[model samples]
Target: MLDLLVIVILLSLVVMTNRRLAYANETIHAKWLEQNLNRLLAYHTAFSFLFPLLPGDASGYWGFTLQQVTVHSNNMFDYFGLGTPFLLFLDFIPVKVMGLSFLTGNIMYGLLGFCGLRYLFLLYYKSLNLDILVFGVRTVPFLFYLPNLNFWTAGVGKDTLCFFGIACFVYGIQFYRRRIISMALAAALVYFIRPHVAFMMGASLAICVVFSGRMKAIYKILFLALVAAGAAVVYKQVLGYLRIEDLSTKSLSGVASDTAGLLEQGLTGSAVDIQSYPLPLKFFTYLFRPLFFDVHNVLTLVSSFENLAYLVILIKALPNLRRRDIGAMPMWMRTGLLIFLFAMVVFSSSLGNLGIIMRMKNMTMIYLLMYCTWSISRRKAELAARATLTHN
Candidate 1:
């Protein structure tokens, strides 16, 4: 009964929010946005309700956490490295104390993930002209409908929270002066959930602030100082979480090799043997594998199609990927690109399982997609301007 009531409330909120956004933004197609939102809501709700019944981490996270909470165990800090216990404790509250069903708790977290996706949509909508079609379809809307983006994030686990945190960080970076609090909160959320990712975000922000010509020198200096101070406070703790003594190249390489070996050990069905592959191949497998050749199930088939679309976008944009074009991008976009590259470098070297790759890469795929789509649009506009000048 409570689940049904919450679903109704969620539907109501979605309709109200969709109407408000459509009314305010004349460029947005009301029907199209509403359809997308409704589909997204359905995907999230369904995945939340069904994932725990499957054989994987979803069941472990939900079942084990509930058991711990019900038994009044204080061992929540045992798996602090992956932030598993933290998420488990979060699951405990609504399920044990508030007496909500697992489905309800999952739906609630799914809603938070939904908010993150919405933030990502708005970021692209404002940053780029989404109406611009790529390959005969509007790319931004189409990208939102990708199944993996919705699936991995619409569950009760680290992926959902981390996705939300990254979304908040990227969106907030666009209007950092006004959205300072949001960015700060995003960093904190990710810090507690995935400190290494938060560290990468901070590093990216620092780089952007230093190189950005739009900000005044005073502001640049202020942010640099803040970044340095924050790094000082958290550097040791993050290293501890990562279980590394230092950030030396040798240490990082060893860590990546060890991680890849561990993940590849028992996961034969889904594992791709990339440990001995070259660096470029590792990155490619991380970002764009499970293509048609690797499809073994319905999920991988959908991901293959999505990845093919992304590949098309990349190929179309490559010729126009000039330094001048990149230089003209907004600070937030550049920061996102940096973060995406950092994550690819870090994870590609360490991940060996395609299933885990799909889930983990969800955090940064939006930035890559946005960058590609924006590049294509910008080049088209430039070509149009050139043609007009030639005509004159």
Candidate 2:
């Protein structure tokens, strides 16, 4: 009854917000943006309710375990890291303290993920001219409508929190000086949830800051010093959490070996045999596999369609990867690209299950999607500008 009541209230709020935005809109584009947001939020809420019935970790582990966890439980930290316990503790508040059902907890987390998605939407809407169409379609809106993005994020797990963290970090990167607290909070959220990803984000930020030609030399040095100091503070802890001996090439090779061994142990039907593939092949498979050739169920079929779109975007954006074109990209896009590449390389070497791959990649795929979309749009705008100059 309470869950239903809360859902009613949330839906009402969504309607109210949409009506307000629609009334303030003077053009069709603004109206469409509001409508898209309203639809996205509604889908997110619906998925939050539907995901708990699906046969996956959210339903199997998180839904059950978080409900069972109590404030007095000593086993919160029984896992290897603090990530699980932190999430458990978070869900415990609404579930155990305020006596909400696990379903309600899922809704709350879904709303949090919605906040992250909104931040991402605003980031792109502000940075890129989303009014520009690609292939006669508004591509930015389509990116948000991908089922996997909402499915993985609108649940009770690390994916939701990590997505939120990554979104906050990326959105804050646009105006880092003004949004330092947001970036810091995002880093901390990701550090507790997934330390290696936090490190990757920090590394990506450092690379972007160092190579950004627009920033002053003094600002570059200051940012580099800050990144170096942060890395120094967390390097050992992240390595320890990951159980990696060191950052040597040999140690990195062991990651692939370990992943191979894990895959060979009673793997399920959705496991991909990428253990024998080369590094480049592994990366490609991670980002663009489980296509039509690998579809086994309705879920995979839907995912294949989404992957097909990503492949199309990649092809469209390939020309923009040239040195000159890349150099023209904004710092945030470059940072996001680096982070996406770093994460893809690392996780592709480590994971073998298709289901897990889909969920894990959601954290970094948004960046790639945004970058590719923006590059394509920017190229179109440039071409239009050139044509105008030629005519004038």
Top candidate on TM-score is: 1
lDDT, candidate 2, 1-392, per-residue tens = 87788767876776676667544542657677787778878877888887787554454234435333344453434432445556665654456456676687678778878878877876677667434554466766667877999988887788899999988898788878899999999998898887767878888888888887888999999888888898888779867855798754345445544644543455456787767889898888889877998888888899998898888888878986556767877777788789888878777876777777787788889889888788777777778889999999
Candidate 2 regions with alpha-carbon error over 4 angstroms: 5-32, 59-81, 129-136, 247-267
Q: Write the per-residue lDDT of candidate 1 for residues 1-392, one digit (tens) a residue.
A: 76678767876887678667655553546676666766766766677776565445555566563333344454544434435566666665555455666677677777878878877776676666435666688876666767788777777777899989888888888777698998999898888887777877898889988888888999999899999899899889878866899865445545555655654555556787777889999988988878999988877888898888778878887886878876688887888888888888888877778877887788888788888888878878788888999999
Q: What is the TM-score of each candidate against the true structure?
A: 0.88, 0.85
- Where's the lowest-lDDT run of ten residues in candidate 1? 65-74
Question: What lDDT score belongs to each candidate, Candidate 1 first?
Answer: 0.75, 0.75
Question: CA lDDT of 315 in candidate 2?
Answer: 88
* TM-score of structure candidate 2: 0.85
